[model samples]
Target: MWVLTSQFSRNLTSHSSLLSYLPDVKVGKTTDTGKFWDPHFDIHFCYKPNMKWSVLFVLGVLSWGNTLATMVPKEATFYQLDCPKEGTLQYFMLKRSGQAMMVDNTYKVMEQNITIHSNGSIIFHSLKVEFEGTHLCVMNHPDNSIHGHEVKLRVRPLPPTDLWGAVYESMFVTGLIAALVIAFIFALGCFVYKKQWRPRPEDEKPVMSGYENPAMNPSDDGESGSTNM
Candidate 1:
């Protein structure tokens, strides 16, 4: 039995296809001396090279998918101001979980025009270009834990008031270019027609009556000759 098991092991490793035709073998009941009464052989199993690589490839794909799912971007708060006049005051609430928190003094204030209150409210006085950027609000909780939040700011200029200015603002560059191309083609067509098809002074001729010239009165001279004859 030991020799048979060794032979199976060697055959399994050398030719993995042996597993397909291998059958289950059960040894006979053991006797008092711990020896089997019947002859049986044990089968050994081994993995093929292609099967091993396929398992590794599947594991790699699963790991990569999990990494991508974890790397998704988080959304942040944003604020926009439309043509805010100078010296105008603006307010924003940075409250979280319905609790009022105080700002951490360790964080430096980058914008002089902005102020943070103990109630998680941010205020911008005399809003200017310097105030239009990212602001960080760091706070200390009751448990002495520190937390930070980011706020984005944007400023836009006033809209145009006149008709042409409004139309220009509403139209994109491609639309403007197309309009100019059409006008240029119309102007070119008008120029070509005037230069090539319009009548010239040298090509014009005067219209004369046939009876006013001697060469055109041949019938009258023939009539007088007949009368003389």
Candidate 2:
């Protein structure tokens, strides 16, 4: 078992936003092929309005092994992640407080190779993730202790396979090109409409329907009639 913990302070001159400071903690464990040494972690966190003694004690109890702690109004949760490779296991977590409370849309981007084994395994490298939601935990949370939702743990490293590039190319770049093509088609249609709409001798302009006005109507007076006669 390996564990790491940290703490920091943030200025609280005004409550313009949910004032919060957090200690990031990391934990790791390994297991054998037997029944239960499987790699997993169970963590607990307590949130206080300020650095209060009671709050720290509460946080400590939850971390130690008190199952009852799980019943507390928890804003952060512990999760178990799989470690396929014995190398560096990079991990991250997000905890929401004050303004974020829910998850809506979440996305993850990986720039390099990622491989998956037949056993439902996953690997990723150079990964970027974006999540949006009401009461989202990472950037926007809505609770006083933490915003709303929380990422208790995240472990990252290079993608495990080589197929990652193809996946991203299909989803992002290909989609963008498709959208542009559609817009171009619409522009062409507008141009055709303008070209066909200009006043034409066929459809829009008035027609000279009454015998071309005779070019010069014969006077009703007898003078013209007599000359022609």
Candidate 3:
């Protein structure tokens, strides 16, 4: 694999150099068999010509993988990016080379919300959800060599809120809970006090009507009845 890679590298360099001089060599000409053809000569006679497309495919895959890796947080040196809540102010600094500083490189971002400074810094006055995407910062030199960096801005949507909004929401919920707890405690205390200390009804006392009572009259009545008999 290494041998093939080295050979392909040399061939690619040679092909690039040849393209400058040979105008007739069409770079993207392909055969009916879906194989890439060499413009200078017959592809079958060329060295490992059948493997060109495969090698190109491998290089493309590697490049794509590198791009994805760079987009991740740990490897974001290639770009300036921020994930801020929507409508918040945000700032970003672009990485620049000394060579870029020495040359007259024009710097600009495409978004209207972004302000590009002379010192390779940018600011977002208020971030928006629509700003979440890859943005380009182009630096064009006097020699017409265009250098560009991608800025990946991600705008997080604001969290949902009720009528209280976010700042007062926690306090409102806490106060409501406290009030409910206090009410429950008061009701429980009243119930316990009623059960433990409240007075109960006493048993009714007997009425004292003297001789007309049943016990008092019973003996006298029986005795009188015997005497009469």
Judging by lDDT against the true structure, name the best candidate: 3
Candidate 2 vs 3: which has more lDDT: 3
Candidate 3: segments with Cα more than 4 A from true spot:
1-113, 141-144, 163-229
CA lDDT of every candidate: 0.48, 0.38, 0.50
- TM-score for all models, in order of appearance: 0.25, 0.20, 0.23
Against the hidden true structure, what lDDT does model 3 obtain? 0.50
Q: Candidate 2: list runs displaced more than 4 Å.
A: 1-53, 61-155, 158-186, 191-216, 219-229
Candidate 1 residue lDDT tens string, 58-164: 99999999887544322222222222222222223232222232332212233333344455555444344434455545545566655555556544433345968
Candidate 2's displacement at residue 43, Å, is 45
- In model 1, the clashing pairs are none
Model 3 worst lDDT window (10 residues): 96-105
User: What number of backbone clashes does candidate 2 have, counting pairs of residues 3 or more apart or in separate chains?
Assistant: 36
**Total colliding residue pairs, candidate 1:** 0
Name the better of 1 and 3 by TM-score.
Answer: 1
Give the candidate order by descending lDDT. 3, 1, 2
Candidate 3 residue lDDT tens string, 53-149: 8989999999999988555432112233332222222223333321222212333333433454444455554555545666545554556555565
